[model samples]
Target: MSHIVSIQTEIRDPVAIRSACDRLRLPEPVFGEVKLFSSSATGWAVQLPEWRYPVVCVVNAAKLAFDNFGGRWGDPKQLDRFQQIYAVQKATMEARKRGHSVIEQPLEDGSIKLTVNVGGAA
Candidate 1:
């Protein structure tokens, strides 16, 4: 049996966030108050590539605050990629935790295909 899952990503797990950052080769997230433009936010600060300010993720509230300056400060694609990879890493981790086996394939369209076998050997 198989299933298709659509995830609306809300970054709340610090471990998963770290895993995603590692997978993307980005800098580790720092937990503290960060300055974003003229404002400030407190959370785990993830520095996206070429971004002027780091994205602050309030894990407890499942919220993210950032100042992109309408793509001038950073490319939205980087954030999108981060979200996608984060979702994949989170799902894969949960599946494996339940003794499921997972296989990942990177599609040509830049999307990933994760095949999970439930109750299967790792």
Candidate 2:
């Protein structure tokens, strides 16, 4: 049996955030109040490659706050990629905690496919 899931991502786990950053080879996220372009946010801040401001993940609120200045300060694709990887890492971790195994594949369309095996069985 198989299932398909579409996730509306909310960055809520700091451990998963660190995992995603490590997977992407980006900087480790820092927890504190971070300065944006004209405002400030408090959370785990992840700085993407070539981005001017960091993306702040308020875990308790499951929200992200950032200032890209309308794509001038950062490429939205980078942020999207981070979110995608974060979702994968988070899901894989949860599945493993429940004694399940995961297989991941990268698709041609820049998307990842994850298959979870129940009870560690293929």
RMSD of each: 1.1, 0.7
Candidate number achieving the greatest lDDT relative to the actual structure: 2
* Tens digits of per-residue lDDT for model 2, 1-120: 778888888899999999999999998999999999899999999999999999999999999999999899999999999999999999999999999999999999999999999999
Off by over 4 Å in 1: none
Model 1 local distance difference test score = 0.93
Report lDDT per candidate.
0.93, 0.96
Stretches of candidate 2 off by over 4 Å are none
TM-score of each: 0.95, 0.97
Top candidate, metric TM-score:
2
- How displaced is residue 19 in candidate 1, in Å? 0.5
